[model samples]
Target: MEKFAMKKTLIALAALAATTAFAQSTATISGSINVGIMNTGASGAQTEVASLGGGANAININVAEDLGGGLRGGFDSQIRFNAANGDRNSAGAVNALFHTANTYLTGGFGTARIGSIVEAGTCAFDPWGCTGGAALQAGTGISALGGAASVKQAVQYTTPTVNGFSANYTSSLSARTNERQTLGVNYANGPLALTAINIKGSGNSTTDGGTAITDTATSQRAIGASYDFGVARLSFLNTVNKGVGGATTADFTSIGATVPMGAYTLLAGFNKNDRATANFDTKISVGVNYALSKRTTLGADLFRSEELAAIAPRTGTAGSGFVTRIRHTF
Candidate 1:
């Protein structure tokens, strides 16, 4: 029965791609699934879990059509699933099959992207996000609680780079809950890149579940830069998250480097989260990857995190994590 179900899912995916690309000028299917053993907080005083946890697996389909006059249109859709059980990733109250979806148009006026789109301030420079290694926490310090990288009902625009500089803006076009807006500007030339991002959301005016609430404005502003030397690349990012309604604010700083060592590459990263509570948390990650081919790799990362400020209400703790996996891409 399990094999039958898996076969049906594959058939459905192929059919969907066919229908989407029936009349498009160009279409492609690209995705990867990494399967490996993962252990988190196994012997620590905190929680414990042992399962098949690797980087998120996805099936992506993209189609594009040239509309002439220096204009083009395309649509991209992605399905994220757990490699362990083949279950979809649930966000908010919905278990969406299409985790990432966007339709875009490009021309002389730059590019306009609509629908569920990538947030403006999320990882434009992170080598991990752009394909480096399989360190599950690739974007750990970028968003709140490692939330989704894309938002719904989002519309965004990117300006054409005149001299290696560009700007972009995005906003959730919804007013029912809270208004969210993001802005980013970046400069990239040669082996250097710099980016600044600001994300703000209007707070709620009413209370829910009998909790009184005030203030509807919260924000997270960050700046990041990176330089690549022939031997190794270094990057740094600092983020300040203004808590909800004058609560506790936090400043998160992350630094990472990727060094190429012949057929093997070394990756190291350090993250510090300083909260208004005076106590803080620090995490260090290091890993090495061996390239089996141009598109395949075998890698393992070791991570340890400690909290001086209580992770629980008033208790500080330490945790360890390890994952080794084989990742392939097309």
Candidate 2:
């Protein structure tokens, strides 16, 4: 009788342990789909079906596990696609099964991330959430890892927030001769948020036949701030790019505002790029969105640009355009 009781107790303890382990780990899948129609001022193709408002049609898979002792580990993977043609999103810019696959660990020591991690502060000030026709001109687009939004074989570390302030650093594991590095600091409290970042591109130099071969590198610095005033939220971003000799290559300034009125919200923005060659590119965008439910929205936008850079070669020149879209998340 004593032996049987001990055996039963052991089995009960084992079952409890298994249940606790399962509860401590989780895997979830979620994503959004955006589809819309667009008409632009481009010469030949002026009207088309595409994801409106620069929103993503993507699927996200996340897996996380508690490591105990104030530590946790996780992996996040995202796959983005074009809703119109069913092609991979940004195929020209990146060709891969997953747009991004990041592995990270978080704890009181802050967070450390690796793999094809997204660049920090890429489009924080973009009211369009950094994806589509509503994106700001590329001249001021901030990317810490080269010109793309994400870089492979990179690592990042962020310090724990203290008094609404924290710092972060990221660098690619590419060859040291031609590497990319980014450093940033952030502050957020109540209705105010601020960020500053510097991205540097390292050039290569070598001695060949007693001649000093040099490649000029460039660096970009940007500052962004936003404040929420209940009825309206306002944002501003300023960016400066410099060449090897500290010569200003370009300067970009943008201002944006969003107003909420119940289920309908209005957005507006203006951007200007000043090139060193005495040339300027400017753009203006205005849009509104109506929330049909917690997971669905309807939106429309009208925008015009003078020499606006192409968001993608396949999308062609945005120029002046209008778009209407339906977005749903699950």
Candidate 3:
């Protein structure tokens, strides 16, 4: 009888341990669906949908394990699709089902993440939140150097906040000689936030035979700031891109403000890009958003642009456009 009771107790303890281990891990699915009707001088009126903060449909899978000693391991994957046609991507290199897949570890040492990850600090100063047709970062070509939205095969590290200041670094693991490196520093306290970012890489300038040339280094530097004062929030950003031999290729500046009134928020912004050879681009945007619920929003925006010197590609000509969108998060 003693032996039988001892064996049963051991089995019960093992069962409890297994249950505890399972309880320490968690998995969740969450994301958003955003769709809109857009009209532009370049691409007329059309139904469109895309991803987070960019009018796309996406599903996110997140899993986390509580590793003891105040450490945790996590995985995040985002699957973006076109709500209009159920396509992986309308047009881009990110045609795969999973455009964003990252593994991260967090503890007292801050956070370290690797894999194909979403680019950080892309929409810090855009009042439109980088959404729809009037998105400054997307349309005005402010973040053209790094392609604005995504980074692949990269490693990222972020430091813990110390006195409302933190630093982040990310580098691509591409085999190319001009692998990109990005460094950013951010600070936030009370209603004011500030950020500075630098991206450095060698241009893929090659000879006629496609031999890689590393003689010239190109870089982009940006500074952004925002302040919230109860009813209104205002933001500003300045970015400069330097080409080979350190010649300034593009200089972009933007300023925007948002005012909230109960469930309605109003936005307005203007931006300009001054490029080399007298080529320049400018835009003015205004919009409003209404909160249908905590998780749903309806918004509309109107924007006008002048693409002098054809700095960036526009639809037909520099003109005006509008977008109406509905978005829901879960």
- Best of the candidates, TM-score: 3
lDDT of the structure predicted as candidate 1: 0.63
The pairs that clash in candidate 1 are: 202-216, 203-216, 203-217
Between candidates 1 and 2, the one scoring higher on TM-score is 2
Report lDDT (Cα) of residue 107, candidate 3: 91
**Would you list the clashing residue pairs of candidate 3?**
42-315, 42-316, 50-55, 50-56, 50-57, 51-56
Task: Give the TM-score (vs. native) of candidate 2.
Answer: 0.81
lDDT value, candidate 2, whole model = 0.69
Candidate 2 lDDT, 1-330, residue by residue in tens:
999999999999999997687458789999888888887544454678875322268888999988777788999888767788766663212245566788999999999999876555646576766546655633212211113345556798999999999998887786556456778888999999998888776522212201111224767788888999999998898878788878887687888888999999998888776772222256788889899999999988887765444443433343677788888999
Candidate 1 residue-pair clash tally: 3
> How does each model score on TM-score?
0.78, 0.81, 0.82
If ranked by lDDT, best first, what sequence of candidates would result? Answer: 3, 2, 1
How close to the true structure is residue 288 of candidate 2, measured as C-alpha lDDT? 92
- Each model's lDDT comes to 0.63, 0.69, 0.71
lDDT of 3: 0.71
Q: Compared with the true structure, what per-residue lDDT tens digits does model 1 show for residues 114-208? A: 98766654354444543222232242212222222456677989999979999988877876355667788889999999988887774212121
Supply the TM-score for candidate 3.
Answer: 0.82
Candidate 3: lDDT of 307? 51
Q: For candidate 2, give the lDDT of residue 112.
A: 94
